[model samples]
Target chain A: MAEIAATASKRDVGRGRGLVAAIAWRSLWRNRRRTWLTAGGIAFGVSLVVFSMAFQAGSYGDMIYNATSFLTGQVQIQRADYIELSRFEQTIGDATETLRRVEQQAGVLSATARVEAFALVSVDERSFGAQVLGVDVERERQVVNFFDRLSRGRVMAGPDETVIGSGLARNLNADLGDEIVVLGSAKRGGVAAMVLDIVGIFDSGISELDRSLLFVPIAAVQNEFGLGDEVHTIVVRTQVDDSRAVVEALGHQLPEGLSVRNWDEVLPEIRQGIDVDRLGGMFMYAIVLMIITFSIVNTFTMTVFERLREFSMLKAVGMRPGKIVLMVQIEALLLWAIGVGIAMGLMVPLLAWLQSSGIYLGEAIVELAKQYYITDRIYPALGPASLLAAPAVMLAATQIAAFASSLRIYWLRAAAGVRAAE
Target chain B: MSSDIVVSCKGVSRTYQEESVPVHALRGVDFEFARGEFVSIAGPSGSGKSTLLNVIGGLDRPDAGTITVDGVELNGLNETELSDLRLHKMGFVFQSYNLIPVLSALENVEFIMQLQGVGPAERAERAMSMLDSLDIVDLADRRPGDMSGGQQQRVAIARSIVTNPVLLLADEPSANLDSATTEDLLQLLRRLNEERGVSILTATHDPIVMSYAQRQVNLRDGAIVEDSAAKVA
Candidate 1:
């Protein structure tokens, strides 16, 4: 029957989303090269952001872990005036009890108490002032990262043995097993002096940490200075993710005179340093995303301009101008999804390899990094946040451009647009 | 359907400012059609044939006149309202089959119903049925690029009536078709008009179209010179 009917055909129907997406899909495939190129730009942009973000976070993680775990433990309990004055008189009296309390606290990984004193060390009649850290042998090993920074003979073996800095040893012209005399003021207002064997030497990449720092057994330093069971500070290592909880618990348990300081509080400068680094990284992310957004705007704008007839034809077929705009936006979003999907696919394996093997920037950086109390190897870290963040930013950015380009549709006359060639 | 005037255009005037010269496309034209009529507006080029169709189909607004389609006034409707009105009540067939190129022929047919809020299964079934009526069901899944000129026009016609619009407006629908295809199209349209009682308004200079139309609207210089009703042989 060759017949047409304008009678209502009644039945429930769905706008097969399959059909619409298929059309969108087909439209993209029509110009596969351009589609790929546009999508490629987004993928490359996202990947760069992801890679850089992961790299920065990884490096910072290493630095923080090393600095807090070794050079300065995550949390430090000190006599309130010890950090400011560094005088032996402002010491924590009976620090062993405080150390025992902190060590038993939940989330506290390890703790060490130290008697820090400034003294004069003389080698071959050449004397130089040095900062000596008197620590318990087993506790010191547990509290600090000695493996990465110890470059010479070994850690201290006896109360009479001392570990000096590479720069200090160089200046003293001292070798392992050589004896040096340490002179300092005893707590009872008397001159105290002792001769110690140099058992080990450490080279921290930072000139300052290596130049004047030395480690000695707590017994020997206490005997030399005549301070009995007195320590300047207690350094505690806390679980990184649990530091807040640990700090809260520590506040309630510690004695009145000993003050607990978290890594952020202990190294506000380093915190600021990290914030600055993050700011720089974020700036780069913003710049890259902006460029990608404009590229999307330009590409979709040209697409809208070129598909004028298609848009108008859609309007003629009873599609609203707003709907036409939506179609364009959806198209851009599809492109974004494609790009971000490709980025995630490639980055997953890439990041895993980087985090495992690590990137060695240079020997100089590796060496210098030890001064900050972090490792020499810098790894890339792609966290869940960055995995979601890069794509989401790209998606939102591309959508903004898609919407902006779609505004042109509102101005297009269906009659004129249906006749446009391109 | 009753003989109510499905479309009524009275004293419709349209003037276009073409770069500086004002061209009067339609000048005080009066026309109307009942619900189940097959009418043609026949004229030479520049006789306001397409212009008259555009105004009646709610595609173009007249400068001075009132047009009522399926009881809705086109004069007061906004762009969106007019678009909705067109989507549900008025369907158009352009001289060049303007099927969305990316859509399959069946999707092109389903386009109007999709816009009219028809569900997928129903629109698909209806679109297939519509294509069957036009003898182009085989071309349903083929995009316009892959279809012949005749098949594309069939798909265009199918798209126009898929929503069961009150008025089907054709502006030279057969302009690009060969004589045989034109005959086939007219015959299919004639069957639709006679059996299903669809009202059709076509603007064309083709003699074959005039032969199929029950009523002929003759326009000269944007005004109706003669309005005549005749029987098809």
Candidate 2:
């Protein structure tokens, strides 16, 4: 009895190993071109995912940095009513103490209080609208390097001095040292107007910001607009690594009238825009992957059909149907592994070039990007997640395709397979 | 009836359903094969020789009646049991030399032993011995496609007897071979039956195959027409 059991186990192991080797050899050599082609399809699908994801990551990183550095700081604190209502009435009466409290918070790196309003700027005949930001030059410099981004003249250093973005300057035909008139309603109501010399021209690499921001000294804005000890918002910066935690902590500690928001909250429209762009990218990738999967399935089905006779012969010699299925599955896995390996091999060089040189679209595409997404050059950056996820996705997709085709082989009747040969 | 009968069939019948039409391939037939017997079932086309062989080999079940091989009643066993019976107690050879083309000659013979749960080292030893007995040991490493039709058939024969089955079934084993190859195969079958004590039942229309059998059963339209023990010296 024991000898029978021992023999049975030994045969099982031998058959298992033989089955694996047979499947591996059949998968590679029987349909050489088709095997390589299927592998190519998987490789292409995986590479697209990896490259596109890396590009999106890089683009989003750029957008976030530009948005935050151009206007809002890493974090912003405002009256709770101001964020919900966005009305002029929600301005804080005493921003000085609030600014002090924010700066004292753990992980708080820098803090500044500012007033903001929307108005029109005109130089001679040309006129354009702009968002007027009131800032303390030194504190504002600590949060955002508006002065460092100047293309013409110096940043505002006095109460009456102002800096205009390059696009805003172009729209209004205003130049450095030229006086531009700003017109809008003051905080109290009636009318408010100011004429200030353009001290600097800044370019933030974002069309929306570059085309419509005018920065001036807070005292000057206060006097011209009758703001009377009120500030619109307080911008804060935290240590980079601890920014999210700092924002969450500050959000819970703020008083009822005040609200703190991260960069994402401050720019909901931009975030939503990015999310839509990401969805579109994902949809495009999915379409490409589906086509690749179909090609692979077709190749595998043909391979199986061609080898029908051989499989029957194996079965006749006591090969189990389940073992046949396992053999085919192992073949698929080998194909996937090879495909992913080739893609990884190709991607390393391609990604390096893309990261260093960037992807150059034609002038027309660049213009379109400027008109819509506000950037001309597309830079792809490698993220760990994007790099590692490509092979996994390919393996899963190929395995599914292989398993679906393997079922036909598994359910094949041994007698029927042999009958054709007879 | 001798108690030494290794195979006994009592009124066995097989009907196949083809496209919703019932085709009676075999009528009720009774037969018996003794241990270590070399037997042949001779018939023309559609005479139920292959069907009868299939039932005895446990590759297919009869629609009615009982088949007992070495005391195990085949009709009483389920599909898995029948598979186990085939794996352990029966081996098959086909006219087409149905050997997996991807496997070498040695691997083909080793397959049955593998299925029987033999270890690799021992399976190789036994398979090599079988190939040596047939004088095809030199072609052990060559795949079936690389060898001649006769060599492939020899491998198939080796595969059949590797597990030392209680019964070996061959269906038209010489139909695709030349006269010389057929004679060589017949000599091997004769030696295996005489020397190894393995029971073999072959279904063939060839007179050359019938000449080697110790007993011959002739079938016509699914019924046995003649049963004779060969007059051997």
Interface Cα RMSD, each model: 6.5, 3.5
* lDDT (Cα, tens digit) per residue for candidate 2, span B145-231: 899999999999898988888899999999999999999999999999999988999999999999999899999888888889523
**Residue A118's C-alpha lDDT in candidate 2?**
84
The per-model DockQ list reads 0.42, 0.36
Error at A350, model 2, angstroms: 1.6
- Cα DockQ of the candidate 2 complex: 0.36
- Highest DockQ model number: 1
Residue-level lDDT tens digits of model 1 in A52-161: 88888887888777777766778888878877877788888877787888899988888998888889998888899999889886886687775357788888878888
Task: Name model 2 segments beyond 4 Å from true.
Answer: A1-15, A89-112, A117-131, A138-151, A165-197, A201-213, A219-231, A236-258, A362-367, A371-376, A384-393, B1-5, B17-21, B68-82, B115-117, B229-233
Q: Taking the candidates one at a time, how many backbone clashes does each contain? A: 4, 1
Measured with C-alpha atoms, the lDDT of residue A279 in candidate 1 is 94
- Which regions of candidate 1 are displaced past 4 Å? A1-16, A85-87, A123-125, A147-154, A170-181, A185-195, A222-227, A256-258, A360-376, A419-422, B1-3, B229-233
* Per-model TM values vs. the true structure: 0.89, 0.84
Q: Is the docking of candidate 1 incorrect, acceptable, medium or high quality?
A: acceptable
